[model samples]
Target: MSVDGDPVSETPTIKEGTWEAIALASAVMLIVWMFIAAGWIILAGEIELAQKRTAVAAAFVTAGAAVVTFCTVIWRGKINERQTNTARDQLRATEEANWAKLLQDGAALVFDSQTGKQSAGLASLEAVVQTQHRLFAKQAMNLIADYLEQVHPTDHRSPLAIAAIDALGSGHSLGFQAARSLKFEGPNKDNKRFAPRSIWVPILGVRLVRYYGGRMDTQYPHFNEACRHSTFEKVYFSKASIKDMSDFESCFFRNCKIEEIGYMIQENTFQSCDFSGAVNFGIESIDDMPDLRPRNNFYWSDRPPIGVTEIDWASRIISVPSQFSNVFAGERLMTKEGRDFIADEVLNLQRHSN
Candidate 1:
């Protein structure tokens, strides 16, 4: 039979078949000898003549069987050992391939942002979320979005749901960026905003990631083509996890201004998503200023049984959008009150009996 791709290894089946055929051949030869001795094939004079004729045929058959048995057994054993040793190598190659694809896509996003090929990279990242591979599907897609947010800072990006669905891939910290970018827009003429595209290039590009089981870590053009049509639109973050983020300090939202976002994260963990100078903030008046604060010194950690796995305030100074107004509203908020507020934000998401 044939298969779509090259068989990863082939010795096990050959080895088993060789052993079976060897045993069958030995049994056949023994049966033939016993029949000859018992005169089953010949009578008197004819027996000697028949034996003479059959002896050469039997010799050839036995030799052929021995050659097949010996060759398959020996060759199969060697090939099987080689295959076993190469298994780890195969896994490593797979991982390297995944990483390469990821870097390629990331680079493309950066280039696209600089060249104005797309307003956002969320659609490109979302394209890979449908992959069947579970290992890094979420991580890779989310990271692409993260890289995009870092590279491009504007309001004309895709909605956050693109990342939300991707985050559902594995719930890693990386996926939180896209989740945090989540926002809702009513179906309108704004296909450039959050809906599907009129041109199928982006969709087709994303569809390729799905074909590779979501492990298209090296396909740059795949992402660049997908988000090529995106114009700077609203980016929202919703239902995020701190444990899903990596290099939290290095990450930024750039110049985008997020709106109408409902995000809940675990407390006392490092901040999974950062919206510092990276986001546009678009604060035109003091009213918006009331809700803005400088965020610093944050990290991510999984919650202990007694704690929660999340992005939390590493220091009292790292205030978030939700807590900005409460911490710095005109006059300085009391130290005790601020600490309590920060503590409350960390502990208030929900009470789980761990």
Candidate 2:
């Protein structure tokens, strides 16, 4: 009976057993004939002739044996090569499984309730990043970014928070398909290190859509702290107030609302950004700013920000109280009304060279 899933032979049953029987009978007949020939060569009257014929037979048999030996060596070599390749493939598969297991175990640690376990989990996730697995890297980064998203708004500098920040920065080493934005939702006294999310998130360049448009670096409006070497690109500072913030170098303030900033804006690059969106973009005088000079212009010697559109001046309140101190693009300010409106607010920001 044929087994399940096994193929049945289609050849006639009479032909199958007959072929093997015929081959066995043929071999038996050949052996009998060989024995008879050996008797004739050894015991017949022409002994000299028999000796010569035996030598000839031996020569032919030796040649045949050489050919068979060569073929056998070639066949064995091919078998070895195929086996080696199969082994290598198996080893690679096993290694990849180990890496996947390591990643899974480490990611689980990050969600544990204990702070120490969470820290260990973060470390494991970072280790996964080192493995250079694309999916793992993305997941690791998302975990840290999510953890940071949980931070409260009191300017938390905790060891764990610090680790999370560093993890995100390191996780995006490859820099493709990144979870770019982090939101600092609000402050909490209970978990002091958890968040001062609103204030510091903006300068970090992650757009806070609730506060700004994209990543709100720091969303809290009413803190008088000094900020340095931060970048704000395509940013909208709608309901925020900054004081004593200095050295905002090479930054792009796009569609920003400069509502009532302190006079200490110094050594900062605010080029290539649009301030046209503000209903009342107001600033205190830059007379206290040490870098203010009649010789230099804010919009001069600078390329426009990465995504700046053609700026319109007439719509907002434009007034240049200091003509020589035009910080915006010099001749590009086309409209009289736009210029008047922009100048009005910017003049308040203009510095006295005295």
Candidate 3:
């Protein structure tokens, strides 16, 4: 007997009891038919015996077919389930591989010091601006800048640096905006602070140093008024250029009591700042002076008689313990020499308004 809706097995396994019963039923049916025929030969009437034998044979075949069908259904269902599980496993594996590749690419972009790859990495990071993976973006930008600075000296001044500077200024998560100002100086020599030679982010260029009057020899509270408005103390440079010291104009001394001005040629600006406690500045120009006048209103100097005049011009001079002179030799708000320079500048500023 064959299973319904399934191909017949080539070497079908017959159950022992069922096979024996089938053989017995076949023999019984054959004997019944033969007996009926013999009776027919003898009496010519045996239709009931033949009908019963045929019905029993049909019932046995149907029972065998049902058993075969049930077994085939169970086997086919298991095979389909196994195939489904295999397909699901393959899909999961592919997803994992893709994710791993992406992470690898990200790390390479961050750590590798190649220009093209660095740019590509940054571009990729920009594409995912809304993503939570901001740490990677910041690290990549830092590394890219470092790499460019290492190779091309002018690259530090390139627009790429400006882009990064803008990004950092944006107060975004992908930019290094929150890190505190740190000055990593070289190893200490002669009681100076020791800092390993490494990357360091300064507080506010040189202006902060000026406002604080460098490192204090004595802990004096001689503050600068400029310190009061240093809202962007943590902001780097504030659009400062390599030519002009933007921080210089922005710096004011708060609660300051310094007596002398200090200057440092940092970046592009000459920082004219006051020093508190003991330190005072004297003009030590690289060029031999023709005439020297104090830019600030007051200066201190041991060499006196040339007290804080409206202006003083000398080949070389120091502002230390300088005498105070109330004798105004120039305009109330202008020095005798700076009048022309300031006049034209102030006029130009108000010219457009009127």
Candidate 4:
């Protein structure tokens, strides 16, 4: 610039420190640029490494979740099996305990029976039967019947015997065998210690004896002898095969129903004995020789008679015949006309005898 013009020499005189200050500024800027480039490169490498580590961690987490799911399924199955086995064992143990208790109770009942405690024994037997153990109840019934027939023959009319009879009646099939062996006879003459006894036991469903091809008397020997002067209250003989009933006399029958008795009953006294359903003997003419009069002797009655009164058929003024209103009330074998005819015959006989 000074060589071109006249003011070149004056302009060529430089500023005091302008060139040095510019060089210093350029150096400082170059060092700053280098540092920035180096930092950017390091940061880029670190971000790439972090992304790889994150993918590896994600893979590990997914594998771990699958393992946990499989282990949980297996563990639950094992637990359920263990619980099922435990419940089965408990049920088996309970059944065993129940069986043991039943055996123990049966033994105890036998002991009571053998120790002369018949009332207590029968009560225990009844309790066992009420438990609905059919086999055990049947066995117990058989044992009691055998005991009564073999050991307690002379123990008729005892409260224990009565209870045993009631127990026997409650059974279905086992009672029949026991009832057959029962001896309902007058007392033995050799054993004067025993009173002149009758069968005070209340018999129910005696018609079942017919199934064994025999009448009640044939099945139970001396039954007629026991029936004499004995009160048979609420006895049922429905559809029974009674061939010969000639010995049924001097007995009191209350609310007894007879269906198909295979005989012409002529001598038996009926006191509320219902023959309306008696198909065989309903039309048979009853004989008057054996005193076919209603025996009012009873152990218990709804309408209890006053005092020790005997029903006298000799007098025309008599208590109303129980058979007229109760037994023969409906359309049965003994019609109203038949009843009237029989009554007139009885009155005529009474007058002739007097």
Candidate 5:
């Protein structure tokens, strides 16, 4: 009538009650039939036919009960499974909604007038990428890039632009069509655009370039890792610095002008790289040579700096530190043939330089 102190009114559905009643009636009838058969056997003195009939009836009753129990179990299992799937779907939807709201809030902060709020927005986007929310991060990156492209550059550092650059630098990969050209249009445009300054645009360890075609004019834009096979057609880099201090590094440059550049790294082969309009190279010594070390000592080591192996000829042209000299000497002297080979390559590069 009741279970666990709950009323029995809600316990049974129509189908469940029907099956329960059938089972109870069948059990009672089976007991009565057995007693009747026993009485008949005692009165009629061992009736074999009657015993066979009783056994057959008992088997049919047992089979019917088994079928009812099995159907009930299967129906309950299906109901439970449907409930579980519905719950999972609801949870997934809720999570997606939360992420969308977070992205909206971050975008609002980015466009805020306050510098602190803008920084917080950038930090939020960075957190998205760092946490492996690839879709959300990519969308945010595109929005930031577009905003940076539209805004005009100012004499003072623009916080929004800086934040955008920081976001782009933080990402491991980027995707967007490059701008056709970069120009400074306002008064003192030349000074603003081509000033002899050291601007920080650090993109240190990005390995993937989903899209890379742009007329970049930023000074001292650092690319310390591989950014090979991207085209820069008719780009201008007046007093710019490009450095790559790692192995198998390469990039592309086509019809680009350079007043003075510090290509102070090693083994960076520039494919189809042209420097027809380049100046300051005819001088005896170059100044403001770009250093290939990471900005902070947190990334520094005692290992010989980047261009050591590729620009081994620098030892002859400039003073070489004892540590680097020792390593180079040992490597060159590994065999008489190796020593001869290095000498020949160095001489070849020197001749070409002149």
Candidate 6:
């Protein structure tokens, strides 16, 4: 203890204070506090009733401290207490390490074995996801995606798989920030986002995928690097929850029933997709409505939704080539400022004669 009441040092780190030093400090503090109380009580003695009451209170406190000091010495003095704490910490570390191993070896438990331990593995994976640490939780999420994709192509998944899929898709288990790191594919099979580290896994990252009819009864499924090149047709999104940050690029979607979706489909393109089945479309625009992702084009096959239908279709906020103006004039969601951008701007597709 120094003259100043700053108990903690300025540059304090976890590795501060040896157990011996800490114990000594505690004992010194205890003694000093007790002495001050005793001195105060004596100095105020034989005075006013308030002073007498204060002295009695001080006496009680000193007695309590004496009891505590005795107990400390008998039941594992400071050294023993410190040792017990160290042991407890070590135990916790061991448990964490074990869980992390289960996280890393998740595929074996999930994909491998017939002892009904597959469910156990999924449970372990969920455990890792619960922690939501970028290291283990991200990998756990990636594994969860792998398991879902393995069963996604087909209509049915084991109850265990469905449960796991929902836990992940809903993003209820992994929290907000971690859920955004999720990916269906990457730039190449060999990479992940710069924030977290991951290895190449099938369905982890791919450029293009053309999905045919399949019942995608899942939650919050997203494709990363393959958005533009992926195509989904006759896919039924049953109970599927599309989050706010989702993106769908030039990929064609036909006869797809998007049962439930809440997202920002920005300067993205939708040429011949039916919007009748799409539900829960979010009202907030990702950008300032007409700024970023400027190359947006919407050509819905059905009547557009409310927020989208209100787009200033006739407003030409930005100038575009007169010929291109004729190309997008009929689009229900196109705004004038949005008109300045064209499909070929991002997709690099050659423009066809209007």
Counted clashes in each candidate structure: 40, 44, 15, 1, 0, 7
TM-score: the better of candidates 2 and 4: 2
lDDT, residue 160, candidate 5: 59
Candidate scoring better on TM-score of 3 and 6: 6
Which regions of candidate 6 deviate over 4 angstroms? 1-81, 113-115, 131-134, 170-172, 176-354
Question: For model 3, what is the error of residue 230's alpha carbon versus the real structure, in angstroms, after optimal superposition?
Answer: 14
Candidate 5 RMSD to the real structure: 14.3
Error of 3 at 114 (Å): 8.1
Could you give candidate 6's per-residue lDDT for residues 74-193 as a string of tens digits? 444555666887997698678678767988677678776553666777787877777655567666776766665564334333566556655564343234222322223322222111
lDDT of each: 0.36, 0.45, 0.35, 0.42, 0.42, 0.45
Every model: Cα RMSD to truth: 17.8, 14.5, 21.9, 32.0, 14.3, 15.1
Q: How do the residues 224-314 of candidate 5 rate in per-residue lDDT, one tens digit apiece?
A: 2322422222222323334321211222232222222233222122321222222332223323333221110010113222322243223
| Tens digits of per-residue lDDT for model 4, 39-118 | 54455567786566556555655555555555555555555766896997697567545644654564456456354555
TM per candidate? 0.27, 0.40, 0.27, 0.39, 0.42, 0.38
Candidate 3 residues 201-243, lDDT tens each?
2221111222211221112121123232232111112211122
Model 1 TM-score (2 dp): 0.27
Per-residue lDDT, model 4, residue 37, is: 46
Could you give me the TM-score of model 3 versus the true structure? 0.27
Which candidate wins on TM-score? 5
